[model samples]
Target: MKRSKALKVETMFNNFKLTFFLQPLHGLPETLSDTANANWPWQQDINWFLALAEFKRLTQQPTLHFFLLEVWSEHTRCLALPLCSTKDGRYWSSLTDVYSPSFNIISSTTLIIANPWQCLLHALTQLQPNWVYCQLSPLRQEQIQQLTKLNGCLRTHVFEHSENWLANCSSNQEYWHKRPGQLKNTIKRKRAKLLSSGSRIEIHSQLTDELMLKYWQVYQQSWKQPETDRYFINWLANYSAANGMLRLGLLFIDEQPVACQLWLVHHSKAAIYKLAQDQAFDNLSPGTVLMADMVNYVIDIDKVTSIDFLTGNDNYKAMWMDFNFKLYGAELFNINSLTGRWLWSKQWLKTTLKTIARQMHHLIFRARHDN
Candidate 1:
């Protein structure tokens, strides 16, 4: 069946005589609320915040199809997947927006399906999303294996691998002892030097709109690029204030803000949202000092079980994180669609050219070194 570009796409899929409902975020199954609240973090509220923030962009001014799926089967709701289909029905993909790093498949504890991958594949067919792709960071070996054997009708590709860092903290003393001795001493030394110079350091945990503006002001002084999502951040700040989920940390030096971080606390987990440090205070290591203090607060005061540094595995993150996980990208294409077939061919050709170019570069470098 072909879809008209103007009509809204909503339907149900069937496999093994069981129907699976594919609905938008608003049409989630009644049982999902308890499951989501128990299994996921505050960030998973992507339905309300992230989706809303990107709705207009994804829809292309009301000319495209955009929906985050909440899939339900006969007995129970299995998972929620992010999906975006273009107006022409020619382009469709898994949602991997800039703001969210992990397009994770959150499952309910009630899931009892024998072959989840097969069921998911059948459900996906109903949407006719020509191409479905997502980056699964830190996926388990078993999950990747299941995805590989999803179905013979679809071609699946595992594109890349990356890493994410996370810190597991139980207490202040434990966290302090886990870090390298050199790091501990350096932070202490910096703190002492700043104090001796009459510079005071303060931590701000609550973020009112007024305080967020102060953070934005200090962020402007930082070395990072101009924030493209200030509006989104402001929206998040407002949501967080009413819910009491915000943990905005600012390192002030004698009444001037130098470094800041925004963390969202949900139950026992705290995820770092955004952080910035003034380049002028680089020598003072305001960012590092601020991080150390925040770590202490997260562990000692908040008593959170874990702190996810989120998507990146930078040198600084490695220094602080006790462990790391791998991230992978997967793309699945439907063989039935002519557009899908054409896109797959173009993708293969592009990949081939890149591979050949890399090989040529390697050979040239080798020859130059020999000469």
Candidate 2:
């Protein structure tokens, strides 16, 4: 059965009436795939969210409740954000930092109203989600301020989430040339070594059970953390392949797959979603060899305009990317609740303790130097 917040229950302010409801994931909205509002349909579309939600339900926690959070004013929709949380609405996050590339909210009008963000605050006043409310992450700094100021919720906190890397592709040759000399030499040496050691390499735009099996085997052999939702990547592979955006690369040494990468190419942009290199092949740099080849293919053959390294500020990502961007998020809790106050107090106490410890360490060091 589909569950919705009661239609009669509404919030009215500034001549605008808001009627929002929590909808389940079983009925994903069609507007989720609207490309007009998305930068990457592959990641922003309904399929991606469904895959993530279903993976959570099947692998991690109890059943998750998805809400189609929409705001309306006399029939005109003002804001639409897809939200997922526990049935009780606690411990919620708008986007999975690992899986999602970006955050999105859609509406015919702006979210400048007084009550757009108060939806959660209202619930808290009525004591719906009592603690550890929701986090909306990877938002722009401006967006963070706007949402925090507009929401009546008192326990709102803004956090810097990640440092991500990206590059604007012009030509594969130029891209290679622009890279550091040391990286270029490393790639050259690794490619020569792999080729001399009898390596088989290929990039596939199609998805097959056999190829996925090889990827899983490589993942197990590689340094990646073990997956709880084993079929999550398989679902992504199937979807990306069917859309002709799949870019799977693998390198095998002595008939054994040692390294693999999964990239998605859509709308003239290529995103490096996942990659793995077996620890055994770390000396040979199989991961680097395979990545260079696929990057070349996506740039020279697929003609992508940009390449996204996706989530992370890893030392390796900065080596290849032309620039980096900061991602921010907002954590919202109702200060009216005791749990909320405790949470804020705990943060303040922690910060104060760190400051005191640092000051003592500095003074002690000065005294030691004088002695």
Candidate 3:
């Protein structure tokens, strides 16, 4: 049976209504694909990797529900977001972080809900989800704040999630110019040293099957094991072949492969999915050199508006990226229920302990320095 519902929301400015349909990935839906591609551009589109069959085969979690949420005006659909929920009514999280770097509610334009938090709470209350709660992950502060403010029944918990780095530039020259002077000089010096040693770096923007296999081989030489799922890799190979969105860059020393990066690009945005380099070539700074080369490709040739380092605050990312944004996780607990109350109490205790620990550490450090 097709499960669907519509709710009307009265905002101060306008009366907004939304339609939601349950999407079971028994097969790929054109509507799902169209909505994903149309709305989300900067982030990786979910439709690219997981199909209905794949999702069913991989995610064996019980009580799972997938929703295609559409906000419609009188004539046209204004916004759409995909949501997953557990049987107990909790938002479905990733089986592993490597599988999905971020979870988001996709929309083409900035969401204009007169009071998004209240509206969302009202919808949830009406739906009467099995569990007294749901949690959305990998959102920024501003996005989480919009959903955190609810009335009496729902309590919110926001956790420190991940840090992402990004560089916004029009051209390679402009990118280099934006970097700190010291870092710029260091990169230039490293490039000069590698070139002087007869080592050449190459980027394979055009991904052929053979070339992709080679890229994987190079990655294995440096990393412990592949963090990405096998199914994901299979999907990526097929997707890249058809879409031409994968960019693999390799650094070579006298024709020997040393470092490799797998980048995914769509529309005008690009993200570094994975990067690895041979430990033996550590002295050559192959990873850094390869990154520099990839940046040029992303900006100069690909003409990407931004490059996301994706979910890390590593020192190297700071060197290249001018700014960063925070990703947060929000858990909405039902204050009316016992289980929800217990969970909230435990969460509160954890936060208090963490705060006390930080204060103690600061005091100890101050005491030592003062002496």
lDDT accuracy of residue 129 in candidate 1: 52
C-alpha lDDT of candidate 2 relative to the true structure: 0.73
Clash count per candidate = 2, 0, 2
Please give the distance, in angstroms, between residue 208's alpha carbon in candidate 3 and its true position after superposition: 1.6
Model 2 per-residue lDDT at 348: 65
Deviation in Å, model 1, residue 143 alpha carbon = 4.2
TM-score of each: 0.79, 0.83, 0.77
**Candidate 1 lDDT by residue in tens digits, 1-371:** 23322212334334334444444432212212343354333335543424443544533334545554555655655666555556454455555544565655656656556666666656666554554332333344566777778766666666655666888878878777788988988899988876765665555555566788778988999988886556556655655545556778877777788888888776787788788888888898877877888888777777898888877667877778789877666666666777656656777788889999999999999999999
Model 2 TM-score (2 dp): 0.83
Candidate 2's displacement at residue 68, Å, is 2.9
Query: Candidate 2 on 275-306: residue-level lDDT in tens?
Result: 99999889999998898899899998899989
A best-first ranking of the candidates according to their lDDT comes to: 2, 3, 1
Give the higher-TM-score candidate: 2 or 3: 2
For model 2, how many clashes? 0
lDDT of 3 at 225: 74
